[model samples]
Target chain A: MAKEPEQEFVTMTPQQKKARRSRSLALALALAAFVIVMYFVTFVKMDPSILNRAM
Target chain B: MAFVDKSALGDADFRLSEATAADFVALLKPRVMSLVVFTAFVGLAVAPAGMNPFLALVSIVAIAVGAGASGALNMWYDADIDAVMTRTASRPVPAGRVTPREALAFGLVLSGLSVMTLGLVANWLAAAMLAFTIFFYAVVYTMWLKRSTPQNIVIGGAAGAFPPMIGWTAVTGSIGLESVVLFLIIFLWTPPHFWALALFKSGDYERAGVPMMPNVAGDASTRRQIFVYSLLLAASGVLPWALGHASAFYGVGAALLGIGFVHYAWRVLAQDPADAGMKPAKALFGYSLLYLFAIFTFVLVDHLAMRMIG
Candidate 1:
């Protein structure tokens, strides 16, 4: 497996850091989506809207 | 990654030499420093009194630097054992990329810088906590308990649990019961968290002769201790909201997470030895990360919400 970004630090410009941040956010969202799908199928079918409501 | 070949740097015609600025940087154990910084930040954010933003920043930076200093000193002292352990074989001092004297100098400098900066930027109370944290990690854990007994993680965990209280002191300039509660949560959480890793990394301790729980007591005893500590950790997880340091949102979230922790512990204890049973221990280890993150995250969030609404 590839090393996680937070596990190592590399010097980068502000723009490079922005790009990296976006990539990380995208990956995290994708993983969260996968978990949500798995839960709905295998476990509970809760509404995603509940998150906003809880806030 | 292949562990055996990881330390080729050690064989680069390596004689113990003075470490450069970069090697000294690595000695601080930046990975552990991040977790310490995060929890400490949460503690500062949730403290009853407000602190100056720049001073708060300075305090957090100083605390992290102090933690790194402690790590460097530990690496310097433990270089002999570290060179033999696969996991730590590549550390600067152990790998001969750095000399012990160089690491010692670097740690001493950082320890002084962090403590002095914290005192100037924050209150003396916060600075004292930072200094004490470095001393506890360097002297108590690294010098004392690490070699003396297998219960090192249990006692030495106090060193790791100091961040939240330190952060709290930075803002309040005095210790609060709530801050102590935060410390207790991490204190209780450490044993099981570390013991699980020790369970799987049994060979590492045996090879290094570190007297880890698995190496000294036995696997069953380690597992039982993990379960007991997890039980206490779960109880402490709910204490913040129960004592009214937090609000309902935190209370409910903690209860659920506490149940999840207990469930993970149960699976680790009752499961049979096989590929199948590995999953639970692994799950507990993984969730344990989330457990600490969520608890501190909740504390910060709930505290922020109250501040805004009030």
Candidate 2:
């Protein structure tokens, strides 16, 4: 019986690498925007008394 | 025509994907999303109650994302047919720039995020309507109606028509007759707009096995239907004024726009079949888009003017 050859990993080209990096950046920005939106939404939903509470 | 099974293409058969961020954006059907956003904004603007600016921004973003998510899901499901249709052949999913699995996951994630965000920032009713709109577009229209029925556009138009109602609910916390009139205008306008495209591009739809009106009912019947729908659409365009929700100024503008739409449709109806160019249908299709935009602009301006006068 003939021995099977092992498969080698394929390396990504520079173009593929750049594409992946850009996609990562976009995802990061989108997630950060979502967080900021949620933060502001929290303030918007809060009662005015909360901000005026005696310290 | 040879159909390449994109799903079957193994990693070994292709190089590493170089799909860009723009490709992912394209999956959102940005053009359609813009119209949804614009209509939703108009709905929000004309509501009896006003929303906080921040919350209004959130509502519009969530609605836009939900609509885009549905579009992504549609691209995922219809990729096979999309590959065959000339108009859709270059779409990210069908063109091999984005995998089906990627598109499905992207759509699902966006759908969840959008619905939750809308619910938290607005009210649950608006959120629920957004969810229903997404489901209706992705499942009912794309998966079921489109391939099986010639009346697909008529029924599926409901999905596109929901954005204004959702926007109204977001601001007022309930639906209103004004929003319903907006919905009706879009609903009645859809058939003539889409059927006009189908008239010109029936070959693309036929090759993709989609049962468009021209392919299923023949050109003559489709043209007649377009003319009839044009009349109804024109009437519906003036309904906000008739119902006293809008001013006479809006009524006049809407009436003129409706007359323009009907004239375009008449050209389509009177066009000779042997001409082969289908120029009238193409012209009607372009004019239909302008008509919708112009009508909505009138609604917004009318609302502003009435508020100032009062």
Candidate 3:
């Protein structure tokens, strides 16, 4: 049987973990806001007859 | 359990940042951003052509974010000077709340995002102006003029002045004489406003090795220059009416505000050098903020009233 390689991990302090979590949440929120803004802008920029094109 | 890897990575490399959301916000300089947003809104409102309310909001937000990004870049570049100055010592990069690298990355990302968003949502002209404003603030003013010259504020003020012009372009898709007048108002107002602060905070600039007007020129010269700039700013404030763009109501308001500014500058100019409190300088600094706010508010109100009546 092949010897199992040892796994390596770096433990984070509680403060570090909390900070990472907070940053992650903030990034998610920012991305969501950007998506919403882009959606609205797309709607605003499109011609009113965009949806009326023949199939 | 996995083996703990203390030796695999250096301690410095492994150290996780403890910076919070508030730290990032501080890097953006919220107070300055508020002024930029307000001025840009007034510019948009006064444009001859109207924009969709939603698009107008988008343009304003993008400009605000662009201004904030420039602030972050400034903090990043001026971290050394900021660490020594009492006024800026608590800033994110200097205070160690955020690393300079992180601040730079944040600023760059926001700058790109804001410029791209404005171009997609508004006209390319406004977006280009926003990009240039960021470059002027971050590279030209913060990196070069701020450290090398006493005329730093005079030149750097152009970056702040561009937002109103950019706002105007977003609507008209081109620059106008009216927008240029708005730009000139802030441009001329900057010298007196900042020199007043420099008069009171000369020690801070001196300690940071920054060549503020008061630190480089004698206090008397700085005060005199402040007075001269105040005179020009007063005239420029009334230019909208003089140029036949704004109504007489705006002209009156502008003239009154201009007189108030000159009065404050005069006090600074006439103050005794022996006075340690520098009360006149401090007062001018305070009034300068009000002067800019009131002038822009007058323009906005005048425009709206004209639209209603005409």
Candidate 4:
């Protein structure tokens, strides 16, 4: 009789899945923060008058 | 989605070792990164020219990432020695949580990302310093000096000291005497601080085949060197105040702190080598950490006060 090839799958545990999700969330937050900071910096650089107005 | 390959999954020997997010974080050496961030922040904050708050934040984040990248690369390269050392045996790379190849790739990616981001958001000078610091720590220190010379920490300390200069350059687009003074403080302080650790951990260094001061120079020589560096560090600590970069308040505080540092170093120097406790060396090691934090805190406080009053 000829043998058939078997397919195997690897799955993460629930805890591992939760940890991956949290890590992804943290990375997303860090990226968002970086974008926000860059935007704010660009705004300030483009308008020196903004500082005087704040004061 | 899981990135596991189907082919890799089919291998009977393949077993995931439960490496968590924390393991990846550990590869960054968070404690060292925190110190890097704090010192870099102080450098940026104390710069004479004002910077956009958002720009300052970006520079700090970039520098922190660069520091973390250096740490990861160091762990990758030093895995062999780290595995042998009791203190570092549990680090991610050595403990089998993070593979060397993965750590190397992570470090290289982060290093490129950090330098590019810093150059785009800040000045090229700061970015250059960041690149050099990473190279110095990972290549110059970890690959070359660590195994070859007893003066490894002495020269490698420059990598740790460059953050403040990078922060300053990010603001002013140039290095100044003030920033150089900040660099000198850290540069000179490194020997005494690390030598104290080496005194107690000579056995570990010997076992790992690292040429730390105590292992190569003998206890008496290492002790003497610690005292000399402590004296130099003490003088360097007061330079900001002496040069009138900081106020009289900072001067008095720094002087007192320097005195305490010298006292501790003196104790380490005078202690009998055969003594079982090694208390003085331990005390000096602990105090060195406090001394650095307190000095930098004073710098931050003085800078803020000046800004407010002016």
| Maximum-TM-score candidate | 3
Question: Candidate 4's residue-wise lDDT over A1-55, tens digit each?
Answer: 8754454556877866776676677668877986787687677567566568744
User: Candidate 4 chain A vs. true chain A: TM-score?
Assistant: 0.64
- After superposing candidate 4 on the true structure, give the runs of residues whose Cα lies further than 4 Å from its correct spot: A1-8, A11-55, B1-17
DockQ of each candidate's interface versus the true one?
0.01, 0.34, 0.40, 0.21
Grade the docking of candidate 1.
Answer: incorrect
The model with the greater TM-score, 1 or 3, is 3
Model 2: what TM-score?
A: 0.93
- Model 1 Cα lDDT, one tens digit per residue, B36-151: 99999988998888776756776787789899999999998999999998889999988876778778988998899788867766678888888888998899999999988998
How would you encode candidate 2's per-residue C-alpha lDDT over B215-305 as one tens digit per residue? 9999999999999999999999999999999999999999999999999999999999897999999999999999999999999999999
Judge candidate 2 at residue B290 and give its lDDT: 100
lDDT over C-alpha atoms for residue B121 of model 4:
80
lDDT of each: 0.82, 0.94, 0.92, 0.89
Local accuracy of candidate 3 as per-residue lDDT tens digits, A2-52: 855544766777877777778788888989999999999999989999789
Report clash pairs, candidate 1: none
Query: In candidate 2, which residue pairs clash?
Result: none
Higher-scoring candidate on TM-score, 2 or 4:
2
Candidate 3: CAPRI quality band: acceptable
> Which candidate should be chosen as best, given lDDT against the real structure?
2
Q: Write out fnat for all predictions, comma-separated.
A: 0.00, 0.41, 0.48, 0.17
RMSD of each: 15.6, 4.8, 3.0, 4.5
Q: Give the runs in model 3 whose Cα sits over 4 Å from its true position.
A: A1-8, B1-14
